[model samples]
Target: MTPLVSVYIPTRNRSALLRRAIDSVLAQTYPEIEVLICDEASTDDTAEVVADYARRHPGKFTYLRNETPQGACRARNRCIEQAIGTYVTGLDDDDLFHPQRIECLVDIYRRHSPSFACSRFKYFQDPAQIERLREHRYSETELARADKLTLPALLYANLAGNQVLTELSRMRELGGFDESMPSWQDYDMWIRLADRYGTAVCTRQLLSFVDDDRSRARIRNSSRRAEGSERFIAKHARLMNADQKRNHRNIQYVMNRQRPSLGEIARNISLGGYKSTLKVLLHKFFGVAIG
Candidate 1:
């Protein structure tokens, strides 16, 4: 039998964006998929909007609503708890999937049987571009290419991005998303998932990530980033070497919109070696993304 893929989206008051997200899932080329939407006590038109989708498409959706707004991570956990599909992946309410996203994940499972799998994504400002980029890429290299990811390398960065496709059992086994994390919740989970199960793979296929304020400046303004990074370091300390810790502590400065002090920079170079320092510097100074 064909496996059922569950795509869960946890949303808040953004009914309009929720509509677009759900539409993208419905538009997927994969036939056996269930859309699990968790409405986090949205006060606006969210109830009405979800009702509209449920009315239009009966069995395709399983909606969960919180009486009071739970945080994003909690909502995601709730959706995972109720998802009936064998395979699962997350879709941020503001992001989108390629029409073939589910099909691609299913194919990956059959081919590689990795514990989990993730892929690259495109950041776009205009919503109209989703259609054009969703179906087409510049070259063949952009499709179906997979690479093995190591835990040590992942400690330096979250190569898996925010979403990964894996079995529902695997997600449950890992305890779902960590609610204690102020941010980097996905990264924390991915590292643990990869470490315990085995190495994971990343593909070059693209998902659509909305490159608006939410993805950029607003994220930098988070008050909890420093706290979250501290928690991350604490949680994953056993998995990191001394140099990785130094680099991570240095990144805490970046997370808080401050430059690393000169002494700290020298310590990174001294302890982590110049090459690792260079990698950290590129992530901090240049626009090169680490995770």
Candidate 2:
């Protein structure tokens, strides 16, 4: 029998945190679901931890360990390739899901029949910070409209959250995640899906317990962020239309002025290309130029 949902987790060296993420899925009230974990060549004992869980759960949990260190995007793609379920959902290694997360999302998808769906998330620092978690409101009807799901809005606020579910076939059709992006991979995927299939259906606060730790705080440290943004803009420049691209270029111009340290500039430059680094230096020294 085909499972109702496949919860895909792409993890690296965060063994202890990964266990919590897995446990959250296992604790879900939704029964007809399988946990698919792709371990991206973690040097830590992540394999051993997953092995322990597999021994106990058997067929319910499927774990794949990679010998090579492909980033999270590739790991996610691997999970999609291995998954066998009617619907697919993603769970970050450090995030948690409410027991009803899958069930709620599945219900919304069935009712609306969207190509993709996302629910609101609550942010927290740790288990102890659960009390401090703040819920953000999102309108289902508003999100269903294309005008409201612009690229600028997406860039300003990553409203997609981590808990997104879509039909397995649609995911494959869209080529899963963009492997080239080291950061904002999810953002890029969402843009593609939105452009192809309209805005994602919102399911309110189904997923919960998003941890905003030092790692998340350092997302800007990604050596590929600026390059990824540029690449994303270039790849989807047409979709934004001429006007939207102009507006986005203006936003990028402003952002370049308020840039981070030289070290960050150097790192991103190395990761992206010398040309990109030169652009950054030019923007820093000479001010924003529309490219």
Q: What are the root-mean-square deviations of the candidates from the true structure over C-alphas?
A: 3.4, 7.8
Per-residue alpha-carbon lDDT of candidate 1 for residues 152-249, written as tens digits (9 for 90 to 100): 77788767877889899988988999987888898898888878887777776675465454554433357776777788899999999987887786
List the pairs of residues colliding in candidate 2.
none
Clashes of 2: 0
- Candidate 2: 10-residue stretch with minimal lDDT: 142-151
lDDT, model 2, position 83 = 91
> For this target, which candidate reaches the highest TM-score against the unseen true structure?
1
Clashes of each: 0, 0
Give the per-residue lDDT digits (tens) of candidate 2, residues 1-291.
524798899888899999888888887777898888999989999989988998998887888878998888888898899999999989989888766667667767776766577767776766765533323233555333321344444533356765578888888998999887766688788777777776567654545777777555445444456667677778876665444454444334434455546765544433212333555667777775533
Error of 1 at 72 (Å): 0.8
Best model per lDDT: 1
